[model samples]
Target: MGIKSFQGKRDTSQTNKAEEQILVSDYMTTKLITFKAEDSLDDVIALLIKHHISGGPVVNDKNELIGIISETDCIKHISESKYYNMPSDINNTVGNNMVTDVDTIDKNMNIFDAAFKFLASRRRRFPVVDEHGVLLGQLSQKDVLKAALKVKGNTW
Candidate 1:
């Protein structure tokens, strides 16, 4: 009877830990890739492909989070414009297509909270910021999975 009670307590403790241990800070990818507003479309595409990332935070010269750019955003622009290999002003085309608004999260936010936001919006990524909304890094479903897999002794 004593052993049974001890086992029950252990199980409860494990459940609580699982529920409480995960936070955004724990799962967020602190090392982030970023883009500038003036960056060319080719530049952004190269960075994304080089890192094999789907998206990243966009920052101003002061490193403040401004927006987010993703493959989806790029495609949206391409489909909307539907003008490839046409003689056009590069600056105007790129400028009009950039995504200028995005959702963000705090580093101290719980991972579950971030997960809920991601699921609700169908957005796979978000920028992680500080108290003043300074860009810290990016958090993605991949980052969360990396953390979770680590916890289970599964290397990412």
Candidate 2:
């Protein structure tokens, strides 16, 4: 799962030999603003707004990665509340609206795999975890781009 273990995906246009040489840990952001599953949607929303991020990773009692909640998820909650004439801030917990079956990447994974994964999905970021499933950091599509730009032989 380290940088050297990357087996470049042959079919991905965004992947190259250089990207395969980088590890996800090298690019993942460790300073993260996270949320808990038991927190209210309003709480998550306020924090997200304060941070100016679209979403954040959800952790459990042990501070392990559990799910994810995003602006899109919040909008869905708002829409549901509106349709029911309820307030989003009143009684909804992040667990009720978060996507539990989250797609995560191991921190040991390479940039090529990470880039291809992002290319295949609509996710803007992925929660990076260790082999034990503990939260470590976050990998964003932008981070992958930086890896690409930093590759050897590439012009700035």
Candidate 3:
């Protein structure tokens, strides 16, 4: 007689269900605090504090992302001003200090790939955009964490 197997057949449907891809848009924060290039750095700082956010996207009149402004950037500007013994210039614009070379994520990208990008780039957040490069939302490290938690053992 042939040897009998003890384990039952695996559930292929369950495996497929667990492997269903999660997209960045599913967890990105659409309601973002955006700034204009002409916006005053002081105002940006105040808003960052008010919203308890470390950074935000800089957009144009059409709401297309131009750059990113962060607390670190503001701090650097402030430090330079103090180092040079120059008084804070209220006229300093976000455009002057914001990071222009931004790495953006595709809204339809897989969440796992986004997590890898975050790890490789060491970026706290990435602006999610469409084929037109229109700013759709932002995906932060925390958002990735939330996605991981949601999937948990199902996909991990």
Each model's Cα RMSD: 4.6, 10.1, 1.7
* lDDT of the candidates, in the order given: 0.71, 0.85, 0.90
lDDT of 2 at 116: 86
Which regions of candidate 2 fall more than 4 Å away from where they truly are?
Answer: 1-20, 87-91, 154-156
Which portions of model 3 show Cα errors greater than 4 Å? 82-85, 88-91
lDDT of 2 by residue, 70-153 (tens): 998988988889778975563488888998898999887878788889989977999988877789999999999998888765
Candidates' TM-scores? 0.74, 0.79, 0.92
The best candidate by lDDT is 3
Ranking by TM-score: 3, 2, 1
Which rank order by lDDT, best down to worst?
3, 2, 1
> How many residue pairs clash in all the candidates, one count each?
2, 1, 0
> For model 1, how does the per-residue alpha-carbon lDDT over 31-131 read when each residue is reduced to its tens digit?
78877777776677778889998777777777888777778777766555555744335653334555777678878787666777889999788888886
Pairs of colliding residues, candidate 3? none
